[model samples]
Target: MAQTAGVKPMAIAGRVASERERCIGMTDAERAWRKQWLKDQVLASNEPVHVEEYWRERTNPIRRIYRKPLDVLFTTLAPVLGQQRAADYRYITGKLGLIAVGVLAVHYYFKYQGNDWTKKGGWRMTRTKPMVLPGQPGFPYKSERCKDSDYADRGFSKSVFGSK
Candidate 1:
């Protein structure tokens, strides 16, 4: 609430306040290029700079990398799909891609690094300890007894469920 005299809150908050402030350390060519970029990309597109900046920060690098290609696709298909439909397709595809990536990441983690038992060279489906129960054959010590399958092979079927 307490703002400095003759200075906006943005300047006080370490943001370059205006074109002049942004140009302070830049060479003439750099300044001209920057001004042209702002004019063509920001102003011509009718998108607010702050809103664009917010989305840039919020989205991950993967999405940013895919954005241009997707934009070109939608733009090219715009005549057939219409503007609204093209936008919807773009949005849906982006979200679905994100979801697919997330699902694959989780699948990879669970497949390899998700469980402590796996890390310790134990059964993938169960923990390190054997799943032997009272009144069962190999009641306490034999790990092979706890597994649902009685296969003697050294794979998924041989291991039993356990916490430890």
Candidate 2:
């Protein structure tokens, strides 16, 4: 391949190394066969063929990403925890763990974080006692019903507390 005018040598070498790494596991014969197959596919197709699309079409996308991590987890735990226990742990953590974490996060947010406004200056409970209306049994000592004199003077009248 012809080198571009200002590109560094290391950058070119890194690109070639990355391309080879994509085919790392194949034997030389298998690599050659795949190369020939890809070339034939490109030649045969009327539309442009993408390498990523070719791989994704043949493999299960979910299995491809999940298989490696789950295998490592199970293998590491199997010897120490026993096979059945390890399998159960994997099932709980893989499926239920995420759901539990999400629920706890939502609960915490609503109970604490979501009430930030109440902490700043919003409505709040007070230590002061509730007001008692005039002429009620506790009016003289406990009532803070009004600051006006007419309400205080009218206290204990026959009209308020029905005649005995």
Candidate 3:
């Protein structure tokens, strides 16, 4: 008859209203106990809920590092270099060829040449003098320096050169 706060009256037909009235005759405590018992029965079931397991599995952080296209190409090709047999070598070589062609296609699409600049019109290029530091000497023109600079040390140099 009277609406309670935050509660709306159900728009039930005559037969449904009679059925609901019969149902509502049960005590509040009885209804509450039955509701809690149903909830307990649901939780006590033996079957594992895969939905919970799926969410729990997803909570783990993924550790793999993301690689760029060039990084992936090099990484794949590096292992193939160690292949010894002719068939394996040929297979790897073909894969490498495909990767190279893909790289070249990307290079052409991006219009990136060996040097950065692309000359437009009939522009002439000018050569610039190399900038040298005040104290540091310019690059050695034609001298043959030892490949290993560790041998440049006095004690090691004599032993390495067999002049000690």
- Predicted structure with the largest lDDT when compared to the true one: 1
Please, what are the lDDT tens digits per residue for candidate 2 over residues 2-120? Answer: 47567655532222235566556656766676667556655544455558777778788787687668768887989999978998888877777679989998877655654222245
The estimated TM-scores of all candidates read 0.38, 0.27, 0.18
lDDT of 1 by residue, 1-164 (tens): 35567665442213233656676776677667666665654453644444877888988989778698888899899999998899999999988999999999888877766545235553445447667779988876755355554343334343574312
Candidate no. 3 TM-score: 0.18
Ranking by lDDT: 1, 2, 3
Local accuracy of candidate 3 as per-residue lDDT tens digits, 1-164: 34566687554333323557547675676566556755665664656555856765655433123223443555576576652453465556667978999998877754543322232433233445566656767643333444676333423454545454
Q: Model 3: how far is 32 from its true place, Å?
A: 69
Candidate 1 vs candidate 3: which has greater lDDT?
A: 1
Separately for all candidates shown, the number of backbone clashes (residues 3 or more apart, or on different chains) is: 1, 0, 0
User: Candidate 1 vs candidate 2: which has greater lDDT?
Assistant: 1
**What is the C-alpha local distance difference test score of candidate 3?**
0.51
